[model samples]
Target chain A: MKIIYTSFIGFVFLIVCSSIIISDLKGPESLILGSWDEVSWEYERVNSTENSNLPLDNLVKKEICSNMFIHEAETWVFKKNNRLQLVKRGHEEEELIYNLRGRGNILEMIHKDNGTEIYQIQDLTKNKLVLHFNFDLQVKGIVKMTFSKVD
Target chain B: MLRKFNNYRTHQDNLKIAILTACSAGMVNVLSVILFFAFTSNVTGHYAILAQEVAKGNWYQAAIVFIWISLFLIGNFTSNMLIIHSKPGKSTYLAHATPLILEIICLLTVSIYLQRFYLNTLWETEFLVALMLFAMGLQNGLTASITNFSIKTTHLTGLTTDLGLLFSMFTKKKYRKDKKLRRKAQILLSVVTAYMFGGISAGILHIKVGYAAFYIVCVLLGIILFYDYSVLKIKRRKRSLFTRKNILFSKKTL
Candidate 1:
């Protein structure tokens, strides 16, 4: 009887505490809204065999960066209705569906007819968003992308 | 390998299952992470995601995660049910083998489906992840139930906690001298090593052969199934030979 009573109390306590904390928290769906400018892209962890100090800006002109969908985009717009627009300076705009998984740490971008891509959300704040994803190419490494929210 | 249950099992038996199943669990977990961008062996992260989805009002995603969690649960339930309800004597081994057979079927289906019909869609990935989770649940359930909860291969959270506790207890000489405690530490260490080996091997295999690596896990589980039957066969043969020799000696003496 004592054990059952304590268990019940513990369960109720957990429920109340969780509800309180959840009410104050904001979901990533709301946090990721509006336009964000691409701040930079760099190798988070380059393959040991690859040149560690290679400049990504020069590499951006190479096939490695060209193959990535986001490489050409200057601005990312996350709109309502689960749509994400990749806007480039001169190229045509591309739209994709967006979803969050893994406690909102996994950013899933589903491209139309191109399948889905996932990025680990390294950091997310009101002003900035940092994403980490595997960059598979001639010289493969983990890529870290930073985006500053546009006012 | 699968016949013994609970108190009837020895440390060697538990160790064998732990190493084999932990390796497969590690492989399945890593494969799911690399291929589907999700986890299969452990549902801890998935539970958090489900909660987040619900809070965000993403009903569709929440439903999908719910299904994945439910399938894992069902897999465990099915395994335990088969074990506890198994008939006495002759059919015990078959009942234990049934869960692994079902697990093999699940993994084989995933492998074949991915190789042939996979369209690289989000829905397909989610479904594959769910199937993998179910298979892992079956494995974990069978190993745990049969070994009296001494072996759980799918995740390390609880194992780590127990190891920590045991380590603290081992600070005292009494616990160190205890045979059961020492054997447990050894089993835990071996399990950790085997799980790491499995994960590393799966990562390398995924790089080399892609999704075809799942077949290796099935092959390993098949060995576990075949081991006990072979041992039984050899033991029976030895018994028969011994009896024949005894009868020949008696006839000569007469």
Candidate 2:
């Protein structure tokens, strides 16, 4: 009985491990390679502004930013070879090269003028992608961009 | 080891399970984060993310987080269902072992997929995350059920809450002196320490060996499963041998 039990366990472990080993190898595919369209944008203040003392002032600023910049329709093309293109309505297309760092969650976009912007990938999927980055606009805040797969 | 299952389990047995399972949970959870950038063993963070996504009106992201939480729920349901519906006869060991075996299979499958066909796609990451959540659900459910909800290893929220409550209660001299409370405190501390150690070790090991960290978890679970079986088999052999000797002695006397 002892031998049988031990052998059974050994057999199962061997089978499971070997099955993994014998499985076909798949080539590494980048998760970010695709055409994406901007679906939504969210902005939140992380730190209070030193100058804006009134609560209503911050709210007005947020409202203005939301109305002015939140719903612009834009498309982004991310190629497999680390090329990125931003397309906006009635605007010149901006071309950039991107490098994915740290488990491919941190995206660093290199601009033509020797500038770089880093965005944290909050979420990524076949049909959806969410990117977040922090910046200062009289107050330190985060901007989140949500994208839907266009192609 | 097998006797603990048939009889009332002692504090030591509970502590052993608590420490070992907590270590396994920590290692698996941290390793998943390192590899997939996703949390698999616990649903608390997923719930928070779901709420945040919903608040932001990101319906697609919300749905994905919702699905991850559901997978965890399903895993727990599956584990408890197996435990509750298992026939109450000689096959009890099989019932108890079933969940662990299932967990092993899940971990093994994830490890195999990562080793063989990891494409770093969204679908692949979601699938692996779901698989891990289910595995953890099985482990959490089994440990909780066997120990009467006193040993939860997968998530630290409840454990930390309990620790806080225990610390508050220990302020009273009577509660501090209570042997049961003391034992519970010791068990909780040991589990927490083991979990932290496991997480730290997994962090270092994952950096050194990558996905092989998962294989180590598999081996740890395999030991638990086979150790129980081996002990049972030894006890059964001893009983049979003793029974045969008694029969021979009776025949000679007659």
Candidate 3:
């Protein structure tokens, strides 16, 4: 009877723990699933010491983002198994492995060719995701990518 | 450093231990930051982050931070507990060394796991942070408790404030002339310098050898253990030899 009571308590504890973990209240990681449409690509200055901040445009993003996996992506689909699919404008898809660090603030995406890129999740909400990254091209500043979740 | 306790510890003993342990703390902190993007040495920032996460409704992240803080507290608790309890063997040095051994084990686990089995998941990173924090807590507890709270090597926020206060006191002639005050200033300065030196070295070493930098931390900790052990052994031998001579002299007189 004592062993049965202990087993019952353990089973209840496990159920409660998993429920809290799987729920969206866990953190930004849960709220970041499904598809997100690319809203805009913006730029911000890193520090006062850095040189004049050149504004980021479509052409500038095209030239500077060769190494960044999200450069040409239109929509990002975060799958269940640490897999991320980047859908390009013409409907081309690129698959990459993604992981979050620093309480889901840092987003690391690893390309199939083994190239990697890191971005800071500046903001994550129920319907919005903002990513911040840096570029050292002719214009040196942080690039901010905003995304709106797709239904 | 490990041999003496409380008021019996000389300034040299405190300074040496502070410098060595602070350097190790600085190195461990930088390595954790570079690898996990988290601070492992101190809990001030973690407390704030915990509150922020909770306020932001990020339960998972908040829970991880809370666990890290709890591990740090538990580590400190474990170290002091070992110190007070291990004296049953009547080995003061061994009692103190016990905490260092536990710290070494904690760091070694992280090092081995990172080298062999780390999958770069969030869980893996959080677990590594927890281990490093516990190790740091063990070190900090050992130093602070043995010194009667004079030397805390794990974090510099309090030390920096103490340094500022010491500098302010040094403006007066009496404070400047006081040997105790002078010794305190010297020790604080040395800790800051050693910590900065260790931090910079870890930065460069990380760039050169990556996560292998943790081995260097393990080596530094080993030196602390070895230094105390060697000193205690020599003292024991000298006491035994002096006792033997006394016995022989008494026999001759008889």
Candidate with the greatest lDDT versus the true structure: 3
TM-score of chain A of each: 0.77, 0.59, 0.70
For model 2, how big is the CA root-mean-square deviation?
11.4
Rank by DockQ, highest first.
3, 1, 2
Give one digit per residue, the lDDT tens place, for model 3 in A28-49.
6667888999988765664556
**Candidate numbers, best lDDT first, in rank order:** 3, 1, 2
Could you give candidate 3's per-residue lDDT for residues B1-254 as a string of tens digits?
89888999999999999999999999999888778778889999999988987797766777677778878987898888888777455978888998999999988899899889988777678778989999999999999989998888889999999999999998999999999989988998898998888899999999998878888988998999999898888988999999999999999999
Candidate 1's TM-score on the B chain: 0.95
Badly placed stretches (over 4 Å) of model 1 are A1-69, A72-90, A93-151, B242-254
List, for all models, the DockQ compared with the true complex: 0.07, 0.05, 0.31
User: Which numbered prediction scores highest in TM-score against the true structure?
Assistant: 3
Which is better, 1 or 2, measured by DockQ?
Answer: 1
Interface RMSD of 2: 10.9
- How much is A138 displaced in model 3, in angstroms? 24
Candidate 1 structure quality by residue, lDDT tens digits, A28-140: 66788898888877765656666754446755535555665554688989887678889888454889988765435567788998676767776677899988774431222
